[model samples]
Target: MPVVTYTLWRLSLFAVTLVVLVWVGMGSWLAIVLAAVIAWALSYVLLGRQRDAAALHLAQRAKPGRSAPADAEVEDAALDAAERERGAA
Candidate 1:
């Protein structure tokens, strides 16, 4: 859930920044661009912990030797059975 939390936080920051910029008489396009940059900068500085947690979570999920999904396991079993049958025949 760290990834989800981090994503929500970033999106919330961007939305608030956009609203504030638009309220200050900035054009919509300019406000969007500036808000995105501002939000990214602010999050990078202020949300370091959350960013690290999210990164760690992603890294763990992508690490080698993780368990295969059930579908993959089942597929492997089927392939093994087919190969054994072919060998026996």
Candidate 2:
């Protein structure tokens, strides 16, 4: 499954669990905490494949260039210009 789809699936599962718990008389905080724990556990057990696939996909799609130093190219250009001026003189 895609990362977005997998994320939505997890969120929906948590919401459903929380709603059920709340309807059954659990307080909001307790329901939210329980739902989070339950969802975390279930996702580990039941959605392992999907989670792994999403992680792999994300890793594969990540680009090192996307995080390169912003000033690297400009600095290289300035250094080259200075070198050329020094050599000419």
Candidate 3:
């Protein structure tokens, strides 16, 4: 949720800047490029809290043994069993 919120905020900033630049008669490509750069800078400066939250969420999610899928657990068990059988033979 935090990641989603941060993404939405960045995209909104980009869109608004793009619209303004286009309205001022900037070329489409230039407006898009400028808007992206401006949005990145603004988000970096203004969205520190949100960015931190999103980063923390991602870090937690990527930790080992953190709610892995059931199929993955089953596959691990099967691999262990196969290794045990080979060792016994």
Candidate 4:
């Protein structure tokens, strides 16, 4: 999985855990801390593949002179393609 996806999954897990703990009469502060710890432990134990993929992606992107393209450039290219298709039609 991509880094963004993995991050979102982890965040979602934390949020859900926090909500459940709070719903069950736990103090908000305590719930928050427990949620964080539980989510991290769960992720560490169960999400090795995703974590590894995300770490590798981050490492590659962090390398000097190596980075993903900007979103604007991707959007421009997509728009150009659409325009060409319209012209052809």
Candidate 5:
């Protein structure tokens, strides 16, 4: 699953767990705090590997000097020209 979908799933699970805890009379404020901590810990433990993989994928995709085709150079020149025109105007 995508990182976003995984995250949302975890969040919804956390919410349901917290609601159940509160419904069981675990004290509203304490349940909220404990649930947040537990959710964060569980998320870190369970999703750490996937998060690391996503980070690595992004890092590889962003490897230097590998982006865009030669057309990017033309785009840059056009942008520079537009900037110069704006300054002159």
Candidate 6:
């Protein structure tokens, strides 16, 4: 799935989980606080993996340029292109 779709799905699941947890007799304040903490921690873990995946996706999308490590070369080319574009406008 796309990153945005996956992220939305994960957030919806987390919301549902929190609702279920509170419905099962946990006190409102406690449930809310605990759920927030757990969601934050889980997001922290998942977001790292998501960021790495996004970086890899971007590297793959970059066009081939000079001969070096493919990702590094692509990154260099992209940077150069960005710099030239900025200089022009």
Best by lDDT: 1
Ranking by TM-score: 3, 1, 2, 4, 5, 6
Better of 3 and 5 by TM-score: 3
Q: How do the residues 1-89 of candidate 2 rate in per-residue lDDT, one tens digit apiece? A: 48988899899889999989999999989899999999898888888888988998888667555666447787898999999999999
Candidate 3 residues 11-75, lDDT tens each? 99999989999999999999999999999999999999999999999999987677876677889
Question: How well does each candidate superpose onto the true structure, as a TM-score?
Answer: 0.76, 0.70, 0.79, 0.67, 0.57, 0.41
- Scored against the true structure, residue 49 in model 6 reaches a CA lDDT of 74
TM-score: the better of candidates 2 and 4: 2
lDDT, ranked from best to worst: 1, 3, 4, 2, 5, 6
Write model 5 residue lDDT over 12-67, tens digit each, in one string.
76897799889888988899988888888887888877677667777876765567
Q: Give the TM-score of candidate 2.
A: 0.70
* Predicted candidate 4 versus true structure: per-residue lDDT over 1-89, tens digit per residue: 49988999899889988999999999979999999999999888878998999999888887654566777788899999999999999
Model 5, position 23: C-alpha lDDT score: 86
**How many steric clashes does model 2 contain?**
0
Best-fitting candidate, scored by TM-score: 3
Tens digit of lDDT per residue, candidate 1, span 1-89? 99999999999999999999999999999999999999999999999999999999999988655865666678899999999999999
Residue 34 accuracy (lDDT) in model 1: 98
Judged by lDDT against the true structure, how good is candidate 3? Answer: 0.93
After superposing candidate 2 on the true structure, give the runs of residues whose Cα lies further than 4 Å from its correct spot. 63-89
lDDT of 1 at 83: 100
Model 3 scores a TM of 0.79
Output the TM-score of candidate 5. Answer: 0.57
Runs of candidate 3 exceeding 4 Å displacement = 69-78, 81-89
Predictions in order: lDDT: 0.94, 0.87, 0.93, 0.89, 0.79, 0.73
* Worst-scoring 10-residue span by lDDT in model 6: 60-69
Question: For every model in order, what is the number of clashing pairs?
Answer: 0, 0, 0, 0, 0, 0
- In angstroms, give how far residue 80 of model 4 lies from its true place: 39
Candidate 5: regions farther than 4 A off: 60-79, 83-89
